[model samples]
Target: MVKGAFDGVTVLDFTQGVAGPHASMLLALHGADVIKIEPPEGDWGRALGELKGDHCAHSIAFNRGKRSIALDLKSPDGIAVVKKLAAKADVVMESFRPGVIGRLGFGYEDLKKINPKVVYCSISGFGQTGPYSKRPTVDGLIQAFSGMMVMNKMPDGTPWRQGMIAVDVTTGLYTFQALAPAIMRQFRFGEGCYIDSSLMRAAAAYQGAKLMEWVFSKGNPPVLYMPAGSYKTANGYIMLSAMRPHHFRLLFELIGREDIANDPDLQSHDNRIRNAAKIIKALNETMPQKTTEEWIEILQPKDVFCERVNNYTDYLQHPHVKATGAVDWIEQDGMGALPVANIPGLPRASEHPPQQYAPHIGENGPEILRELSYSAADIDAMLSRGGVRAPAPAVKAAD
Candidate 1:
């Protein structure tokens, strides 16, 4: 077997839902052994969205390449098992609210005492301290609070959440970036660090530029460049970004609006922004005369930045996307084929026909317990007492 970047790393993942799970999933993708510890009922994400047997699309998407071990943390024996696993793990991640894991007796402080070099990470809504630290929050609330929703408001001025969970997903990326560095520090200096990551913080970081603009301008982000938004065409909408002077000139020339292109008042960046309304009105009248494809054919050769606004289906079927191998087609049981996206910085050749299915609840409990040196009788006692779970017996097909 070939070794990967994180081949020797073991991760104790006590996270559920998107943010934390996604961070650990990235590590797993790079070859860390991520042991996902869940409740007896499984990660709550397994119950979210459309379901197929024990898993949902949400769970399946974020949990590839991890093993599930359902343990009742309320039980003393279960807590001991978790501590034992933590003792041997290179990284530990949890998404519980502030102090939740500490109450469960497995916070960074506790884990560090046993394993001083453990890279501990905590993901939450408001972070580990503050008046709102204990207040419950999710991705949508973060979007609203961090100015993302306002920045993405409709042209009619009605605020709406971004169609996807942007904050959670971005927070996952931030978490992974933080963890990778912490692991490096441990190797260089024998120091394990505690990371406090929050969706609110990630949202702010993601929208730093827009937030700065809004603050400086004291209003909505001004159109710095004319012809930089979506325009309706005869068949569909096409996004345009003819920001540079030469590109703007080419766009107008392609549309046969050289009068507007040659206007001296529209030449400089400031003048163009000042005349935004006039430039947009001209595009509104002229673009609808041709189809999006026709405009693309005319403008692409001129280097005017433009593309047809693509829905998910169009994106999946795009020739460039396919040629670049940006998605993995995995045949999941019951779910048929799933198009899993390939994360950047990983080998495309090694990404597909996903190495493992999202595990069932308690799917790896027996194997993990055996590694912990528990006897068969000891494992049976823990199972009987509801402290642990073994994978459900596979259903045999009828002869």
Candidate 2:
């Protein structure tokens, strides 16, 4: 097999929760040596998964390609251990409240003196420099701040949070983008960089459409052309929109109602908005006659750009998804390989599999300290100083 891109890089992951760990996971997936440093209690993600296993499914997704070591930063020996690792590490990823790491004496300033080539990344909800930086928040808080909570309206007209930790997960991806370049620059430019990866910043990017409209249009969206949502088509529904004047024409053409296309009353963007109700009525009646499949085939081919609003299961099972290999399968503990969606440019082989189990809290302490070149006496002193912890054995996987 071919070697992966980041085969020799070493990343010391000090992040907890989703955002930071996710960044480490990406680095690990592509073949970096990601050593996840956790408190004696382990990452909270290890517990969030519904199952009682050491590896929570959520944690597994982001931690597959890493090793684990437990250290207590508050302890002098633990601080010494991590500082020693920092001296040798190329990248250090942490997701802590603003001043926490600095107080622990492992901040970028503190680490850079020991290792000038170390790229230190901080992932947090607000950012490292904001007044709210010290205030702890979760994905829900980020969604509310980013206005994503109301972007999608439920059938009940209630605003709801994004279904998953969209904020933390995407923020992780953003961190990777920031970290990788800095790592390269450290080698070429000879100085590492400090990065602040904020969930709010990442989530704000998701509002690009609304932001673009507000910027260019100089006010609220043409609620009149809010691309008035979904319409009924024969057989199944289609996500019909009359955003542009031309799309209206396409809608008319697709429905075999050319009269509306030429009508002066229905020609302009604003006019379509005024009459969206009537036009939608006609489209609703016409669309349901054909199956969603039929219209998707015929209209999309005609550049009408129509689609069925499929349920999650239906979308997952859709032939196009399978044909494109958009989803792949993974092995579960009790179950065999189960379907998992392949992310964009997702690894086919080089990527590590999802973690099957989290290391027992502090499970690898002795081994990790050994790799750090700590002598047995030194390691025991740290352990004695409350710098290290060793957990009980993990549930071994089947052979």
Each model's lDDT: 0.86, 0.75
For candidate 1, lDDT tens digit of each residue in 1-399?
Answer: 446678779999999999999999888878899999999878987877766677788888889888889999999778979988999999999998788899999999999999999999999998899899999998899988887777778978888898788888899999999998888898789889899999988888888888789888887578668879999999999999987889999899889999889998899888999988889899999999999999999998878899999998999999999999997678667677778777777766344445546777788899898998999999998888888866774411111
TM-score for each prediction? 0.94, 0.83
Q: Per-residue alpha-carbon lDDT of model 2 for 1-399, expressed as tens digits?
A: 346567788898888878888888878767788888898778887766564446556766777668888888888777777887888898988887888889888899998998888888988889888688877899889888877776654756686887788888889888888888887788788988889889988888767787777678875455657245676655556786566778778767777778777778777777776776667667666767777787777767767656688887887899998898787667755334556666565465224454323354566678888998889998787777776876555532232
Which window of 10 residues has the lowest lDDT sum in candidate 2? 349-358
Determine which window of 10 residues in candidate 1 has minimal summed lDDT: 390-399
